[model samples]
Target chain A: MTRYKAVIQYDGSDFLGYQIQATGRTVQEEIQKALTKMHKGQKTVVNASGRTDTGVHAKGQVIHWDSPFSIPVEGYYRGLETLTPDDIAIVSVEEVAADFHARYDVSGKEYRYFVKRSPQHDPFSRHYALRYPFDLDESLMNQAARILEGEHDFTSFCSARTDRESKVRNLYAIKIMPTEDGWIFSFSGSGFLYNMVRILVGALLYVGQKKLTPAEIKVALDKKDRTALVSRTAPPQALYLWEVFYEKDNKK
Target chain B: MTRYKAVIQYDGSDFLGYQIQATGRTVQEEIQKALTKMHKGQKTVVNASGRTDTGVHAKGQVIHWDSPFSIPVEGYYRGLETLTPDDIAIVSVEEVAADFHARYDVSGKEYRYFVKRSPQHDPFSRHYALRYPFDLDESLMNQAARILEGEHDFTSFCSARTDRESKVRNLYAIKIMPTEDGWIFSFSGSGFLYNMVRILVGALLYVGQKKLTPAEIKVALDKKDRTALVSRTAPPQALYLWEVFYEKDNKK
Candidate 1:
């Protein structure tokens, strides 16, 4: 069997999430179904860097699977392209080492969230952005973002449902940049807990709205309690898995 | 009664068409439903600048409606905002002269068509752009567009189902500009018949693909027969009613 790693991009508007669930459409089910078809009735389990929530999009989600057939990488790409729905796209496929694991081998990750700063909702961008009607102070939001960056316990920002034993994560950087009519919050880190990026963005937005101060965010982080942060978790539609970084030497 | 002229915008992926038909959900029905609800059971009729087919989006579709209540223009805008779906937005609303008619007094119109010139389809833009998986020569397309400009009988490019008495309309300009990953074909004209913009774009794409020469397009125009053009009418998803121009002296 040949182990192959592939990069994927998807518009997650219609998907329930990235993982398989009891009901509703999902990204994993779509890809696995396509693989099973290509393999001719044999079930093929695939592993991914991580699963995203419903309405959360992805630009470079990574996954790996073992193929029983000796098909060229381009052929696999084409097969998947024809089999999967239009919303899912295989960006690239390459043969990987047998020991390579999509989830365990991940060195870092990058996520981005979008917020539309207009008072009125834009019809064209309603599905892709979180429409915030109120004014936002960009500099305040950035200051709050800076306070949250670094290696720290992120229990305050993680989802309550996260099953991981360790809530400590190394958050490398957080940058808020201005787009034409909105702001894009980019986060790069060693890893993220369930809903961590969305929660972080929500907290920063509170800072921008003057509801919470930068010092208040620091206090919330020190508390390490999910309830300590009063901000609502950011919605899923505007969130995206921008990239998953693995060890450069191992792959290239 | 105060006559209001409003500019509306909508993402037409979920809409059947601009006109109120016997069956599926349409932009006109959505707007009219909102108006009826706002009027408290009094059915309010609206007249649009023009009707667009299914999956055809609009950036600045003008409409006129008469209101029985004495409400401020901003009040009308806010009312529509709270009543309409997220995919539809009221760009602006103002009281216009009673003589102003949305359909009859139209001076000119502009339409835009997007073509993704990449071989691979982008999942994020699947609803908005036409994924043409072939290389196209920009200069050739522009040369062909230039030949189709000016006043002529555009019956060949008009849909055969159109019931208009006159098919002779002035096409003021046809500009094919290159976008980052594709091309934007902008059409500005005195008026257009059914499917004229889409058919024109289809013929130009044929010219770009070398299937038909620019001179052949001229002959097709002279033929004034819809069957003379072998190209297919471009799909509605990539088409947008960019703007509907009116006489400046009437309204600013």
Candidate 2:
């Protein structure tokens, strides 16, 4: 069996998430279904870089799967185009090492969260941005974002349902940019917990509204307690998994 | 009774068109419904600058409505917010003279048509731009567009369903801009016939594909024959009623 890695882009509007669930269509199920069809009815399991919550879009999601029969990398791209749904596209496919793993080999990730501050109804922007009528102060939000970089116990910024052994993660950088409709908060990190990026963005948004100060965010991080956080989790529609990075030299 | 001239913006996805049809929701119908609710069972009629085809969006569509009540202009803005649907917005409203008309008194109109050439899936741009898979030659299209400017018989570039007395119209400018994903063609003119803009854009796209020449477009205009045109009509979703211009002194 040959292993192949594929880069994916999808609109998460109708997807439950990246993982399998009891009900609702998911990104994972759709890709696996397509693979099974291409493999002549034999089931094929695919692994992804990470799981994105419902309504979260992706541009450069990475996945790897073993093919039951040998096929050219270009064959996958040409074949999947006819099989995948309108909202999903196979960006690129490449032959990978037999032991390559999509999820375990990931080294870093980048995510973007868009917020539309304008009250005007822009039908086009509504699909990609979370519209917030409440005013936001950019300087305060930027200050809070800067303080979020580096290793920290992100327990306060993760979903309460998470039960990881350790809540520590390394954040490489955070960039806040003012867009035409509103602002986009970009996060690059070694790893993120469940709902971690959304929670981190929500906290900065609170700072922008002047409800919480930069010092308050620092204190919340030091406490490492979810209950001590003042920011509510942001919605899922505006969040996007921009890219997933993997080390080339770390071949299995 | 007080006459109010309102600037409107609406998404045309759920709308049949700007005109009242036998069934299905229209932009005019939605605004009229909102007004009827504000007037407490009093049916309201709104006259618009012009009608847009089904699935055509608008940003600065002007309309005039005579109200049974003499309400404050500011109050109308606040009141209409709750009455209007999520996809529609009353951008501005002001009291106008009783003699002022939205349709006949118009000076000029600006229409924007977007064409997305890339095949990649961008969920955000999908709502506003029409996707075209074939390659387009920018210079050939621009040359054809320049020849289309000036007063001429536009019968070949109008919907055959139209029954206007005169087909002669003056075009002020035609600007073709290449965007990141594709191209946007902007047209400014004294007035446009039924489906004139879309038909004109369709002809230009054919030129970009090397199916026709700029000289052939001029010949089609000279013939004033609808059957002389070879390009197919463009879709409505990519067409936007950008703005309506009026004399500054014509204010009511």
Q: Assess every candidate by TM-score.
A: 0.96, 0.90
The DockQ for candidate 2, computed on C-alphas, is: 0.38
Clashing residue pairs in candidate 2 (N, C-alpha, C atoms within 3 angstroms): none
Can you give the DockQ of every candidate in the order shown?
Answer: 0.83, 0.38
Q: Candidate 2, TM-score vs. the true structure? A: 0.90
TM-score, candidate 1, chain B alone: 0.97
The list of candidate 1 runs beyond 4 A from truth reads A248-252, B248-252
C-alpha lDDT of residue B25 in model 2: 89
Report the C-alpha lDDT of model 2 over A82-194, residue by residue, as the tens digit: 78887788898998888888899899999999898886666655557888888889888888877889999998889889999799999999998887768888999999999
Report the TM-score of chain B alone for all candidates.
Answer: 0.97, 0.96
- Alpha carbon deviation, residue A135, candidate 1 (Å): 4.1
How does the DockQ of candidate 1 come out? 0.83
